[model samples]
Target: MASRDLVTGKIFSLQTIVGILGNFSVLYFYLFLHYTRCKLRSTDCNLKNLTVANLLVIFSKGVPKMMAGFGLKDFINDFGCKFFFYVHRVGRDVSIGTTCLLSVFQAIAISPLNSRWAELKVKAHKYIATSNIFCWILNMMLNIILPLYVTDKRNNTNFTQKTDYGYCYVMEDGTVTMKIYAALILCRDGFSLVLIVSASSFTVFILHRHKQQVRYIHRNNLSPRSSPESTATQSILVLLCTFVSLWTLSSIFLICLTVLNNLSLWLRNTSALINACFPTVSPYILINYDSRVPRVCFA
Candidate 1:
């Protein structure tokens, strides 16, 4: 049993490290380019926000998993446990919020000229950063109360249990704390999911419309190849779609586990891995699909 646990931990730790390092590298390139020559356009700002959110996810969730793998769970004392979990929960929410915002911004950017939100494009860059900052502060404030509801138990006494597993919530006899915590998590996740779905759907609809228009223009010989902006927009659409799909699947799994209450440890851990893997894979796609990279490299 010990050997099995050790192997599992090692695998997860390595996976987390790879994901974190990959995201950091991609963020560095994007930031450096943006500062040197690339102006802070709406698109660039959105991407930067996404990268920052990814960094938080890596630190809060990925690093803890890595530490747990190395049997450093004890390093997280009572205070450490509460703070770590707090950050982990809040960081994940922020990531979801930022991604949803990115999708909405991108959709609005590509909306028809006469659409209701079309005017937003002109002034969006000015306020997008402010909005992102608000999101971070809002989420942090909301999650500040989490530690009050959580604590570390030394052993399985009544409602508290210390099994081979690392950190967990042990339901005390007749205490509604665990249920309350679960409900809060559900509410937060559900709210973010709704936003993600709405934004992703809107972006997909606009992308399809734009693609059709591009095809029509090509058929009439009005244009030969897609415009550079169009190409970049399409790439972002793909990335957003991929992110939405992966997160949706993982969210579904989480909902089932939380509600049905029959998931095994393997299934739970697998879901965590899936959630982490999306941000890990996103950076690679961003770098490879970025059209300006070649220009920047050559310049």
Candidate 2:
């Protein structure tokens, strides 16, 4: 049992390291490029925000796991515990908010002039800052209550052990509160998932239409490269597709673990690994997909 645990921990540690390094590299590349250029278009701003959010998650969550795997359990003291968990929660919330905003922006960018939502694009720049501020505040308020529930105290030796680890949490009064918490989490996740799906769907439809239009113009012997609109559109579509796929899988696993509660230890860990893997893999995808990055150099 000890050997098995050690091996599993080692594997998880390696995975976490990969994720952290990859995410950090992505963040640094973007920051370096932006500083050298001294300016970013609106799309670059969105991508930069996403990269920063992912970097925060890597620092708060991924790095800690690597330390813990190397027998640094005591390194994360009570203060570290609270601070790291808080940052991890906040970073994850920011990622969620940013992804939703990215989708909305893509939809607006692609909306036809005659569409009702077309008017929204005109005012989007004004609200971008405000929206991010609102998301931060809302998430902070929602999760401020988490510390009230969790604690660093170890479990009693004689208690029927469900989870091997200990953290802060209010004692379950009954199944009712657990159910409520589960339900609330599900609702929040579901809402985000819906937005992602809706936005991605709209963007795809718009892209299809735009492609048809381009083909039509080509048939009429019109030049297609007159505007760089197609390139930009394709980039946004890729971003949306990547965001939706990664987040949706993580959200689904979280929902299952929260609601089902009967999942085995291996299954739970597998779900967690999947959830963590996405954030780690996300940075590499951004780096590879961004046209500005030299592929061979990064490779």
Q: Who wins the TM-score comparison? A: 1
TM-score of each: 0.83, 0.80
The digit string of per-residue lDDT tens for model 1 on 60-86 reads: 666666666566655565676677667
Q: Rate the local accuracy (lDDT) of all candidates.
A: 0.69, 0.65
| Predicted structure with the largest lDDT when compared to the true one | 1
Clashes by residue pair, model 1: 156-161
Give a tens-digit lDDT track for model 2, residues 192-212: 778877988888898888787
Q: Candidate 1 at residue 116, lDDT?
A: 85
Report the lDDT of model 2 for residue 93.
77
TM-score for candidate 2, residues paired by index: 0.80
